[model samples]
Each structure stands twice: as structure tokens, then as C-alpha cells.
Target chain A: MRGTMLYAPFDIRFQELPDPVILEPTDAIIRTVATCVCGSDLWSYRGITPFTEPHPMGHEYVGVVEEIGADVTGIQPGQFVIGSFATSDNTCPNCRNGAQSRCIHGNFMSTCQATSIRIPLADGTLVPTPDQPSPGLIPSLLTLSDVMGTGWYAAVAAQVVRGGTAVVVGDGAVGLCGVLAARELGASRIIAMSRHEARQKLALEFGATDIVSERGDDGVEAVRELTKGIGADSVLECVGTAESMKQAVRCTRAGGSLGYVGVPHGVELNGEQLFRALIGVRGGPAPVRRFLPDLITRVLEGRINPGKVFDMTLPLDQVAEAYAAMDQRRAIKVLLQP
Target chain B: MRGTMLYAPFDIRFQELPDPVILEPTDAIIRTVATCVCGSDLWSYRGITPFTEPHPMGHEYVGVVEEIGADVTGIQPGQFVIGSFATSDNTCPNCRNGAQSRCIHGNFMSTCQATSIRIPLADGTLVPTPDQPSPGLIPSLLTLSDVMGTGWYAAVAAQVVRGGTAVVVGDGAVGLCGVLAARELGASRIIAMSRHEARQKLALEFGATDIVSERGDDGVEAVRELTKGIGADSVLECVGTAESMKQAVRCTRAGGSLGYVGVPHGVELNGEQLFRALIGVRGGPAPVRRFLPDLITRVLEGRINPGKVFDMTLPLDQVAEAYAAMDQRRAIKVLLQP
Candidate 1:
């Protein structure tokens, strides 16, 4: 089997690797049908998050089950499926509470950029499509593995409601999806904060009612002005930088909420500021599994097409190009064919 | 008029001061019915929160309207009222959103300790009781001005629901009130974290089903053990220190919420820690005005008795002794009469 590995900063290698097999009774091996590079992948690829050893990369994929462990139930071979970037047994206390990302028996998936991947907790982690999806739907379905679901979680966490306003503080793929999620959740006003023309256009297409190109205090003022000086009822922070979090917090109205999904790098929140602003904050890795079923249905019903986030597509062997293109801002996201 | 003044640390003096008069059309002068020493007053009393000059002290009060400016409406002279520590123009955006503490036109009341208090936004700030209450009900009704309302806000912010579990961190007047609030909200298992035997007894009387005397990590461990190792569904942080905030965070289950009513001092939250725990945090000065009507009704109906927290009583002239009792931890809370 062939897979992608990061040898060092700015170095991605797609080469021959041993095929995956069930290592535990709860595991299943799936043959990758499609995979993709994520914005988070750039963290290690840029060496911002250093690594001592070369490691397998990628956490998003749509695949076809090849074999299942003896103890695996509710899942069978030859089925097409989509799974969360984080694996969960789905019955633990946290999972039952809709926080599968924090499930006691969970592990983040890090080796999905391969021909064949071994998935633990298969019965609980993977949700099968009613039938094998057509090629066109594959891209959209693949997004359900992380970005789209994360965006949905962001909207849910922000407590976005019908007839309310929302502010999305990032223009990345996830942020674009968040615009769609907020719209679906019935936010009457969706503001997308973006300076890039192309991303701004995509945001509008994804249901953004307004766009603010300014950054920092100016951006906060713009949002406040748009919200009648009260700020948005909900704000989705798709970037984990301190600046983005601060902007998101300032964009939310008193009694409003900010939902942050981006992995934090060096973000610190002041208790006093949050208290004075009366903002409710909830953030973390997206509990993708919790939203997988509903999102999958939404995609299959053709109600959403999040695959539009994939601006570029490449062969799985060109995995290096995928990382480089996203790193250089040449691609919003790259879908990979395995 | 006479008022309590804090000249410096440990230098509280009851002295003659200028009588308060209406300065705004919306202002209403109230004769003090009852005012009390608050835990927060000790911050400045202890010189932890410094003041540049001698200042009038106190924020909690249940008073009778003595005079009203021309524009004041809905409240009449001689009407008994219980108002929030923070006055608000309830028509403001924040107030309409149920966060009156952050109202656009609002101010924290600091002159209530005096014989006469000038309240801004009189029509919006004060809620009249059904009628003048008997002396026995005054203390309980007075609590709606701050402590009891704050505890109610903590439970409300934590999203307490019937049959859920709650953990109250801090055994001060507000925390004891939180135990009562949790019970009123229908929490099946209310855990009160208190090291003081007297406070523990009061908490149990307020409907706490369990008490954990441990502090810090040991306290968190004890809460976890009682909660089936999942932590409580809602945790109230009534102490503002960083340690209390951290303990409150750890005691909440993944996807649970922490409502911190404590006015934070030097508290900084690491975004990464909160992200990994999937904890939702919301805190601030309680919007007591929002809860005044409901709480007052509860007291009038004899459904609640928060006045028990005031174990000691003093004449208004003994304001200095009231502060001393609370400062020395000799009284849970002290009620004052003019």
C-alpha cells in the first residue's frame, strides 16, 4: 500500500508502505476511496508543531470497508463509509453527552492518507452511506469526516438560532462551511470576515449576508456597526490564533456565544474580559461523530455541497503538491484520489 | 445624611455625608430599608482593590422610595422596592437580552449604605414587591438585591436542568444561595464544596445532597467519585481566584458548563486546557435585575428563605462592626437596619 508521511518541515513523501490489517477485535481495515489534506496538516508540515520522528499524516477520508475484526458488529466489508477524524466508541459517557472528541476510548485519526487504513472502534466510529456514493458526491461526503461537521459543531456550540445574526471570523474552508451551517441553522444575518476576494465570493455563495475585510479593532467596529452596535448573536471562530479568538469574542453581543473549533496554538483568554462582555464560550476539537449522521443525510439529500471548499484536486501520489499548494495559499483545500 | 466610608484598609468610619438628591430625571432617592456588607466590599476594605480617596461603601439594599425625579414612572414615593446592585435601563440591548448588568446605561450602586440612595434608571432598576413586607421577610427579600440573585444567575448560566447534577465551589453567602438556587431549579444531586461546618449545615438545609470538604485536585477527585467519574453536569464558581476557577473547570464534565459569578482577580484561562476539556464557561457580575421579580415572588410565597445566610444583624450606625464580622469570617453575612 502507498501512504503519505512527513519526513521534516516542508517535506511530504508518498511512498510504499505496508497494508493495514485489523490489530484488535474492535478494529477494521478500510481501503481509502478518497482522502484530503487539512489546514491543520500545515501545523506540523510547517514545523510550527515540531516532531522528533517522521509520521503518517491526514485525518480525513471516505473509504470502502475491506475487512472487519471478529468482534466488530453493525459494520461489514464492502460498504462505503465516512468517519470522524477522531475515533470514539460512541457509548462512553462523553460520547453519550455529544462530546465524542473527548470520549475516554477515543484516539485522533492520523494515518488516513493511505490506500488502506486500520480503524479502531469501527462499529462506533464509521457511519455507512445508504449506498455507494457517486463520484461527484464523494467530495462532499468526504468533508463530513471533519470540516463540514466541525462547522456544524461550531454553529451548534455558538447556539445559533433562527432569526438571529452570526459572525464567522475565518475565511478558511471550515469558516466557509460555518457560513453554510449558520444559514442552515436559520441565522437571518451571516457576516463573513474575509479580505480575500475569492474566499469572499465563496463565502457569499455559502450564505454570508455581509463581509468585513478589516482586521482587529476595525473589524470589531465593522461587526458592531452591522449588528446595530450590539454585536452578533453568535460568532464562529474557525482560526485558533489569539487575534482571531479576541475578534470573535468582541464580535459577540452580551448574552451571545462564541464557538471556537480551530486547534489553539498560543491562545489565552482573560477571565475579566469574558465576564464583563457576558459572553458564553464553548470550543474544542469538533465532536464530528455526533453530527455525522445528520450531516451525511443533509449531503445525500443534496441540501448542501460543502465539497465546493475543495478548490484543487490531485492524485494521492501528488500528496506533496497538495500540502505545498495549501501552505502557499494557492489552494483552499485539495481533494486526493487514492 | 450618614454613610459608611472606607478611609483606608481596616479604617471604616460611619460619618456624616451629604444627602443624596435627584441629579437626573430618571433618578429616584430611596430611604434605606436594609443594606448589608458584601464579600466583595472586603476587597476594598482589605485594600486588595485600592481606592485613591475615602469613598462611600456598599451596593446591596432594599429600600423605600423617598422621592422621584420628574421623569420617574411606575414607582411611587413610599413604595418598598428591591433593586439590583447594578442599575440598568432595562430597555437597553443588553438588558433586553437578559444581561442587565451590562446594560448600555447602567452603573453599580455604591451609595446604598447611606440613609438616602439616588438610583439611576429608577423605572428600570427597581422592582416593587407585591406590597410592604413584614419585618421577618425583609432579609430574604433583601438578598434579591445581590447574593441570592447572583446564585440564581450562576445556576441559570450553568444551564441547570431537572434531574441533572450540580457542584457549587465556594461556601460563601452566594455559594450557599447557589445550593438553594440549584435545588429550586430541580437538580437531583446538589454537591456543596465547603470546608466550614456551619456553611455545610446551611448548604444541606438549602437542599445540598452531598458535601465535599476537599480543596484543589483532591476536591475535583471527590466530585468525580460522586459523579460516577464523569464530573458534575453543572459547576458554579463563586470564588474569583485562579485556583477556584481551575477547580470549577476540572469539576465539570465534558460538554458541561461552569457558571462563575465571582468577580475575577488576576484570572487567566489557557485556551488549550479549556479546548481539550470541552468545557463551556460563562461568568460575570450577576444581572440581578433580571431575576429580581422571580426571586421576590419566591420570597413572598415563602418558597425560599435565603435570609438565613445573614446570621448577624447590626444597626446602620454599626456599619463598621458589620464589615469586621464578615472580614473576620465570624458571620456568613450581616444585615443592617437604619
Candidate 2:
């Protein structure tokens, strides 16, 4: 199987790798139908997140089960399935509490950029489609594996209330999807903060009622002005930078909630500042597995088209191009057909 | 008028001061019926919080309105009233969102330890009892002004679900009140963290079902052990130190909520740590005014006795002694009869 590997910063390569096999009784092997590069993956690709050696890339996928371990239940060979970045038992205390991403027995699905990948805890991680999804629905289903689920988690974490205003801080794919999530959650006003024309257009298409083109304090001021000087009722932070985090908090009204799903890179919160700001703060690795069922339903019902976030698609061997497109912002998100 | 003045660290003095008068049309003057020294006040008295010149002390008070400015409405002179440490207009966006403590036109009340104190935003800050309260009910009513209100805010911010377990970090008056608030909010189990026997007794009486005396790492371990390694569902962080904050966050299960109402000192959060912890964090200065009406009703009905936290009482002129007792931990709280 050909897989994507990052040996060093800006060094994405497509190389032949051993095909995956069910290694554990609860594991299942899936032949990838679709996978994608993520904003977080760029952290390492851009040399920001450190790595000592090359490793398989990609954590999002929608595929068909090719083989199943003897102990695997509910999932069967030939079934089209969607699974989150991490496999969770879904029965642990944390999982039961809706934090399946932090499941004690979970492991990140790091080899999904390959033709075949093995997923552990298959019974808890894989959600099969009602039928074999058409290729047109594949990208949206793939997003349920991570990014779309993550955006939904951000909206949920922010406690987006009906008729309330919600602000999304980042203009990346996740942020655009957040606009969709906030809209689906019943926010009457969705404000997307984006500087790029293409991304801004996508944001609006995803249900953003307003856009703030400024950055830093000016950006916060813009959000405040838009919210009539009180700040948005719910702020979604889809960027992981310190400045983005600060602006997200500043753009939230006192007693409002902020859901930050971006993997923090350089973010730091001053205790006094956060305390005085008086906004609820929550977000982390999204429990994507938990939302898979609902998101699949939404996609199947044609209620949402989250896959619109993928602006570019490439064959598995063109993995480097996919990474480059995302890194250079040429694509909001890039899909790979394996 | 006479007042307690903090001349310097450990140098409290009884001094004659000009009587307070309405300086704003929205102000109202009140003669102190009961005032208390707060745990936060000790920060300045101990030189932890800076102050170069002598200043009037005390922010919690229950008093009788002596006079009202022309603009003051709804509250009449001679009414028994409870007011929080801060006065808010309660009409601003923040106040409308239930964060009255951060109201746009808010100001902290600092002359409450004196015989007479002027409260700004009288209509929004003061909540009057049905009638003149008997002397026995005054102390409990006084707690509504700050400590008890703050505790209630902590419980609310933590989102204590009925029948869930709540862990209160810190055993001070506010923490003890947190136990009571959790119980009132329908928490089936309340764990009070304290090393002091007397405070522990108060905690138990206030509805704590268990007490964990361990501090720091051991404390977090104890909580996890108690919860079968999952940690508490709701954790009230009543202490604001970095260690306490970290322990509070650690003792909370993934996806749990942590309400921290402490006046933070030297606390900072590594963004990655908080992002990974997956706990909802919310709290700041308690919006006491928001809870005033309900709390007053509870106190008047004799459903709770939060004033038991005030173990000692002194005449207004003995303010120095009152500060000393609380500063030295000789009293959980001290009431001043002005």
C-alpha cells in the first residue's frame, strides 16, 4: 500500500508501505475510500510541531471494511464505514460522559493516508453507512471522521443557544464548518472572521451572517461592534494561536461561552485575564466518534454538505500536492482518494 | 462616622471618617446592620494585595437604607437590604446575561465596615427583605451580600447536575458555602477538601458528605480514587493559587465542569494543558445581585444558615481585632456591629 510520510519539515513523500492487518481481536482493517490533510497536520509539516523521525500521516478517513478481527462485533467486511481520528471503547467513564476522544483505551488512527489502515476498538469507533455511500457523499462522510465532527464539537462546547450570536475566529476549513455547525445548532447570527476572499465566501455560504476581516485587537473590536458592543453570545475558536485564543475570549460577552477546538500551538491563558473576562472556556480533542451517527444521518438526508470544505481532490500518490495545497492555503481542505 | 482602615500590612486602625452621602443620583446611603471581613480582604491586610495608603475596608454588608438620592427607585429609606461587594446598574448587556458583577456601570463597595456606607446603582444592587429582619436573621442575610452569593455562583458555574457528585476545593467560608450551594442545587454527594477540623465540621453541616484533607497532588489522587479513577463530575475551585487550580482541574473528570470563584493570585494556565483536560472552565466575581432575590427568600424561610460561617462578632470600633482574628485564621469570619 502507498502511504504518506513526513520525514522532516516540508518533506511529505508517497512511499510504498506494508498493507495493514487486524493486529488485535478488536481491530479491523479498512481500505480507504477517502482521507484528507488537516490544519493540525500542517503544524508538523511546517516544522512547528517537532518530530524526531518520519511517521505515517493522516487521521481522518471513510472507507470500506476489508477484514475484521474475530472479536470485532457489529462491523462486517464490505461495510462502508466512517471512523474518527481516535478509536474509543465508548464505554469508559470518560466516553460515557461524551469525551470519547479521551477514552482510556483509545489510540490515534495515524496511518489513514494509506490504501489500507487498521483501526482498533472497531466496535466502538466505526459507524457504518446505511448503504454504500455514493462517491459524491464520500467527502462529507470523511469529514465526520474528524474535521466536521470537530466543528460540531466546537459549537456544542460553546453552548450555542437558539437565537444567539456565534463568532468563529479562524478562517480555515474547520472554522467554515463551525459556521455550519452553529447554524445547525440554531444560532440566529453567525459571524465568521476571515481575511481571505475565497474562505470568506465559503464562510458565508456555510451560514455566516457577517465577516470581520481585521486581526488582533482590531478583530476583537470588530466583533464587539457587530455584537452592539457586548460581544458575541458564543465564540468558536478554531485557530490554535495565542492571539486567536485571546481574540476569541475578548470577543465573547461576559458570561458567554467559548469553545476552542483548534489544537493549541502557542496559546497561553493568563489566569487573571480569563478569570476577569468571565466567559466559560471548553474544548479539546473532539469526541468525533460520538457525533458520527448524527452527522452521517445529516449527510445522508442532504441536510448539510460539510464536504464542500474540500476544495481540492487528489489521488493517493499525489499526497505531497495535497499537503502543499493546504499549507499554501490554496485549498480549504484537500481530499485524497486512496 | 467611624470606620476600619487598613494603614498597612497588619496595621488596621479604627478611625473617624466623614459619613457617606449620595454622591450620585443613583446612590443610596445605608447604616450598617452587619458587616464582615472577607478572605480576600486579608490579601491586602497581609500585603499580598498592594496598597500604599490607608483605605476604608469591607465590601460585604447588610444594612438599613438611611437615605436615597432622587434617582434611586424601588428601594426606600429604612428598608433592610443586602448588597454585594459590587454595585451594578444591572441594565448593561453583561448584566442582562446574568453577569451583573461585570456590569458596565459597576463599582466595588469599600466603606461597608464604617457606620455608614453609600451604595451606587442602588436600585440594581440592593435587594430588600420583606420587612425589617429580626436580629437573628441579620448575619445570614449579610452572607448574601458576598460569600454565600459567591459560593452559589461557583455551584451554578460548575453546572452541578442533580444527583451528581461535586467536589469543593478549599474549606474557607466560601468553600463551605459552596457545599451548601451544591446540596441546595441537588448534588447527591458533596466532597469538601479541608485539613482543619472545625472547618470540616462546618462543611459536613453545610451538606458535605465527605471530606478530603490531602492537599495538592495527593488531594487530586484522593478525589480520583474516590470516584473510581474517573474524578468528580463537578468541581468547585474556591482557592485560586496555581497549585489549587491545577489540582481542581486534575480532580475533574474529562468533560466535567470546574467553577473557580477565587480571587486568583499567581495563577497561570498552559493552554495545551487546559485544552487537553477537556473540562469546562467558568467563573469570576460572583453576580451576587442576580441571585439576591432567591437567596434572600431562602434565608428568610430559614432553609439555610450560611451566616454560621461568622464565628465571631465585634463592635465597629474593634475592627482591628476583627481583622486580626481572620488574618490569623482564628475565625472563619467575623461580623462587625456598626
Kindly list the per-residue Cα lDDT of model 1 for residues B17-121, writing each as its tens digit: 999989999999999999999999999999999889999999999889999999998899999999999999999989998989999999899977778788999
lDDT of 2 by residue, B8-112 (tens): 899988888888888999999999898989999989999999988888888999889999999988899999999889899988888899989889999788878
Give the top-scoring candidate (lDDT): 1
Among all windows of 10 consecutive residues in model 2 chain A, the one with the lowest summed lDDT is A268-277
Model 2 DockQ (Cα-based):
0.81
Model 2 chain B worst lDDT window (10 residues): B268-277
| TM-scores of chain B, in order | 0.99, 0.98
Candidate 2 stretches with Cα past 4 Å from truth are none
Candidate 1 residue-wise lDDT at B79: 95
Predictions in order: chain A TM-score: 0.99, 0.99
